[model samples]
Target: MAEGDPSYIDYEAFLDPDFSPSSFANTLVTSTNNATDTPLDLSTPLSRVLFDLQEIDTHIHALTTKSALPLLSHTQNQTAAADHILKESGTQVAAVTQGYERLQKEVVQKWEAADEARVAAENSLATVRLARAVSRCLTLGKQLESQVAEITGRSATGAATSVGVDGASPSAGRDGFRALERAAYTILSLREMFSAAAEDEEGYGLDRVKVIRTLRGEFVIPTENMIKSRAQQTINRFSLSSNSANSSNGQSSTSSGYKQARDARARLATAATTLYLLSPEPKSSTTAVDYKPELLLSTLQGYMHTAIMTSVNSLARALSQLPSMDRTLADISTRCQDIVALEASLKTLRPPPHPLLASTPTAETQAAASTNSNLLQPLLHALDTSSLPSYYWRSLASSLTSRVQEIVNRGGVSARTLRSNRDRLRIEIKECVLRASRVSATSLLAEKGRSGTDTVIVGNWEREAAVMVSSVVGPLGR
Candidate 1:
């Protein structure tokens, strides 16, 4: 078995690169970096991780076969006894004892079957994590590479410095370093799987526990950022599409005005598909959840910080061109802005410092400071009650609030696409978000940050962080 080789295993069999975890990394960083405009090194690490996972998955499958043996043997013993009893003249027997024995045997086989599976699933999750890690790494890697390439392209001679985004300097970008940290976390998650599997109970039917839950534990789902990023990629592709269209066919309508709604819809569809294909596969998520809506909400929140702000900014630039959808879109944009503002307000809103100053900041004081950092929950609740309808509601909601809304609902185009993806990414997104929400942010962030693949990228943070901070500080310096 060669390392990074796809020969023994099927990469496409487990996940589609077009829409799978593979898709996010394989396409994202490569495209972001490609001087050639195609996928390159992204697959190398993905293949390595996938290969690692395939090896582990095979082992887990073998363990499942092993765990079933005791149950099978017990069943056979009972069958034999029952047959003997039926042939000989019926006698009462210990079916309860036999069943208990079977259960005990299985439990004895794997002490924490569910827990072990949870661990393995967490480990297996690294498959996607690795992909995301590499994707971000590649993107940031390219960011550095572009610097080198730019320096050398014109100079065309002297050697450039060995330092890069991969370098461990705080100055390049406190933000850039943060991006590197995220990428590292994801890769580490992949690496951590190897050790996590080793840590499981001996001879335990952990595979049996997989049936109980889908790798139950905290996992981050990057739903919001993913969608926003995808939209960003999509928008870029469409800008090209329009250019190509104009070049080949000539502009059918002026770049300005509302009369071009028909052309606009066509453009949007083209952009959506282009975005779907070119869109980077999202990072693996660790958020846990029991159901769907909570997951979706969490995802939207995540994206609120990343591409949403950029997309809305693009949309604003595009209004003259999107005049047909202007009024409805403006309303939606305003609502989204409000959501962003509220989120900002929450981040800033904190209790005043107590009048009693201490020699050292107490544990209680630290806890209180930490509490100031997370106002997302209560603020979200307030918005849910007081706000205009969510965009998700446009399709999932029961009623339409306005006639102009007919543009979105007219043919159910967006709804159909959204529905098709219902089972694919969003569910996974939801699960991931829920799992993340369960964990302590400090621990979660720290854990992911340790991995070169799992650190945060500041350009992608929700825009309202500063706003939230400002609001929390208020008029007086408390």
Candidate 2:
């Protein structure tokens, strides 16, 4: 074939496994001759094919010979370029490796330095917070100490002062109550500070500080105990004096006597308020048996217990005597009146919020404190009764039931009298309940103007009277 010719024989056909040289030759001869004409000679066409193959082979040899030197030069140039690129790449890789190592060392050093600085800053912040906590503890301790001293000084000087006919100097009582309030507030503040420190991570070590420990041991603990003792003594004294006063007065005291009683009640209220302020936060115990109530609540409950015991004993003795039943029931009515008075006083004794106690003073918190301000609420909660009078009568009934049963079990003359006078005993019990209810109702009318008819009683007197009579008469009948 000539160079760049469009028409050419397929050289790939000669390499094909199925290619037949004889069939190709026959086809070529048949294509060259007509069907009815002379048959073409194979030798002539085969000689022409052989000549064309020789010419094609010679052309290929000539072209290869002409291109050999240029191909060799191009290959040599490519190899040199590759060698140069490889050398440059190796040098750059080494430099980059050195740079990376130096950068890694610098970054590691900076990171370590920054980490140490951060740790130091955090430690310093913690130390500062701890110091502030210790300072606050010391401040509260000093305030508590001053308050205790004031209370002590007032107590010491009050005995020498010109006391009222009832033995309490008005000025001294006022000063004593003020000092007690301040001391209670200070104690509460110190307690809250300690509680906050316990919750804070930085201030956790505050209790371990030497001065703090000393303050707690010397001032905090002793002052708390002293205040608690003083308040408790005051309450006990008030309860006793009130009982005696009620017994002597018999609802017919003069105006001056009423004034004295009012003053005594005011003093009692101050002491109760102080105790309420000094009351500890209620803790959740894991079990009911492990639960302990507030100190103020326990004290009030003790008062109620005393009242129950006294009433039970008096009623038991009256049952034995039978003739004194009327007098004994009257005394119980007076005791119930005292209970009503106590409940009213407690309901009215709302302690003002301490400035130090409220950390974040808000309208909502103030309102909540005001709403839950009743000093008697904790006592009521512990007794599980809303009405103190109701609780007292019910508890008396239960105790009196057992006492009556014990007396009847003896089967003596006293028991025989009790069974015979069961109807009279029921009437006296009902009269006592009605009298107590009338007294409470009269007081309420006096305070907030008369409402409804005079015949209407204030509480469930019928039910209470029935309960008391049943407890007493039921045992006697049996």
Candidate 2 Cα misplacement greater than 4 A, ranges: 1-118, 154-174, 197-204, 232-295, 321-330, 350-386, 419-431, 438-462
lDDT of 1 by residue, 200-284 (tens): 4221233233321222121112322332343344323321222222222322322211123223323333323222222222334
User: What residue pairs are clashing in model 2?
Assistant: none
The lDDT for every candidate, in the order shown, is 0.36, 0.71
On the 0 to 100 scale, the lDDT of residue 275 in model 2 is 76
Clashes of each: 39, 0
Error (Å) of candidate 2 at residue 473 is 3.7
The candidate scoring highest on lDDT is 2
lDDT of 2 by residue, 1-478 (tens): 3456543667677779999989887777777666676755667677768886887787778777888899899999999999999999999999999998898789977888999999999899878887888988887777776666555543432343456555655554556655776777778767766655444543467776888778888879888999888877766655322433442343444233444556556766767867767766544312211222267777788888888899999988988898888888888987877677678778887655543332444676556555556777767878899899999889999988888888889988988888888888888898898887755333222322334532225566788888988999888765
